[model samples]
Target chain A: MDLALLARLNEERAARRAAVLVTDLQSNTQRLVLEKDIMADPLSALLSDALRMGKSGVVESDGHKVFLTVQAPVLRIIAIGAVHISQALVPMAKQLGHDVIIVDPREAFASPERFPDVPVHAEWPDVALPRLGADRYTAYLLLTHDPKIDDPALHFALKSDAFYIGALGSRKTHGKRVERLQTIGFDEHAIKRIHAPIGLNIGAISPAEIALSILGEITAKLRLKPDGTKIGN
Target chain B: MLATDDDLLRQAEEWRREGRGVALATVVETWGSAPRPVGSHLVIDAEGTFMGSVSGGCVEGAVVTEALDVIESGAPKLLEFGVADETAWQVGLSCGGRISVYVEKVT
Candidate 1:
């Protein structure tokens, strides 16, 4: 029932770290639900459920309704090509609150002169992907048409927990590329996650259009289920 | 109440102590080009109260009715409205879109 402890718990939760709050619902008084007590307390179960689901809710404690708010951290997008499509995609993704990093071995393509505001990594994917350590929130996009540039990145993406992995190319090129991945021991499911011939089926021709389509697909994948239901489901 | 959810909750508590009724409306689902995303919230009180939006005025009237019902019953209900509904044009939204709203009594 300590308000100061509840405020501290809220601050910790806002920082994307896990913290639990217990409340006497009838009195509208709250207590910090610490990690140590999570194993034994029923309220901690609700907190864990909310954390797992990335949801906020009103929980009944004692006899009152206590609002539990959980804030999920932002996701990261690793663009493995500094092409024209990326020029448009980076800013758009940033607007949507994604942390974006552009990577390319070609110094001329991956320069601060081209992308003044965004982070550009002028190293190859082999060196960069390990440093990044892909998580569930990390999305990887291989925009370089060159297999030499994309293949290593794809290998790392396939090994990691990245939610979305897309590679830009024509259908024919993607088919050939899939064959190469198969040779490298990638199974069908792993290759399927690549989203080759990237972007939604919007028939995009211009670079900006292509970027829009890619972002649309990314948004759909991130926010909506395959059945078109919202992600909370 | 000033800003922030805590302030709003405190205000809601004070209103309850003063015998005022309040309802909460949340956007649970949207379909075929909804202007607002799911999980968006709007709150309404006894005296035609309002806060936030569900669908750019497309379903506010329907939400208001639902909110009144929630306030009366003190129970939550999930309501769906779309352009396909016969009365959708009367509410100013007939763009062939749909939304599911969850209405609950908050105070």
Candidate 2:
């Protein structure tokens, strides 16, 4: 491996970007593939799957063997509302290798002592999320049912490339939320992206159980594309 | 099996830079009862050091043996083992499953 390529790979890691180093065994030639540049690679069609799955492996291409060394950014979760559910979720997300941040304007709830292991932001989601760089690797969970808090964040979550957007609300509450979003000019498709009644249908009744369901749903949305769409055809 | 290093590629790179010959074995495919998921890796260095796992305890020894050969010969090899088969039982992978791993030098 060349020093230049090694440096480039490190650069991607530092920037928290997903990429692959494609090495052809027959020629001993290697190419660095940042996730953004996947479409331009000759093997782009075959390579994106590995990128999506966040795994590196040898691939057969036109009778030549290619080794794809995958590098994926760390997963992150931004949970709005330092409520009881978040108490359970913060640690659970951490256990699953997620860097979790709990954001709330309530000083009483968003205290360092309460969540010593995770980062606590005593700011509104709209204010906190932008500083966090909303991207494909980010998942936003609106645990607070307050419209003033969750609504502004929804504006940004819908507009950004955040992979998963989930909010806690009942069907009736979501209906009202949908009406509000429509009044604010978002189309039906954009409004539909919010996974209201957040979490999977796991019949969860407690804070911890609901947190588990939400995390499971978030993981599913991240790995399998939202709306159950397949990538690269 | 899969060891502590979550990022196997970086570990392999470090090993190579340390003057250790390294080979990476990745589970490209798996079927029924396979402990590790597809794309799991086990990187073995020339000095008989390894990190991460391809098949828990079921197939690491065989993959490590092949990985060392891949490091020496600079050749890539594809391996398949079925846990249900009698031959596979002696080697490992007796959990009644099958997996295909691709071993290659990390150049």
Candidate with top DockQ is: 2
In model 2 chain B, which range of ten residues has the least summed lDDT? B1-10
lDDT (10s digit) by residue, model 2, range B7-104: 66677777777878888777766778888876677889987788888886777888888888988998788788885555644575768788878787
Interface RMSD of candidate 1, in Å, is 8.2
TM-score of the A chain in candidate 2?
0.90
Cα DockQ of the candidate 2 complex: 0.27
lDDT of 1 by residue, B1-107 (tens): 34333333344444555667877666665679887665466667888777667788878977888788888877667677786764643554467787767676654
Per-residue CA lDDT of candidate 1, range A1-233, in tens? 12245346546534434555443333544466554456676676787776555565556666655655444445678999998999988788877767789999999999999888788999999998898676666889999999999999999999997889999999999998999999989998888888878999998999889988988888888777678898666
Off by over 4 Å in 2: A1-14, A23-29, A53-60, A65-70, A223-233, B1-5, B17-19, B31-33, B72-76, B82-92
CA displacement after TM-score superposition, residue A213 of candidate 2 (Å) = 1.9
lDDT: worst 10-residue window of model 2 chain A: A224-233
Backbone steric clashes in candidate 2, count: 4
Off by over 4 Å in 1: A1-53, A59-66, B1-107
Cα lDDT listed for each candidate: 0.73, 0.81
Best by lDDT: 2
Q: Which ten residues in a row have the lowest lDDT in candidate 1 chain B?
A: B1-10
Residue-level error in angstroms, candidate 2, position A51: 3.2
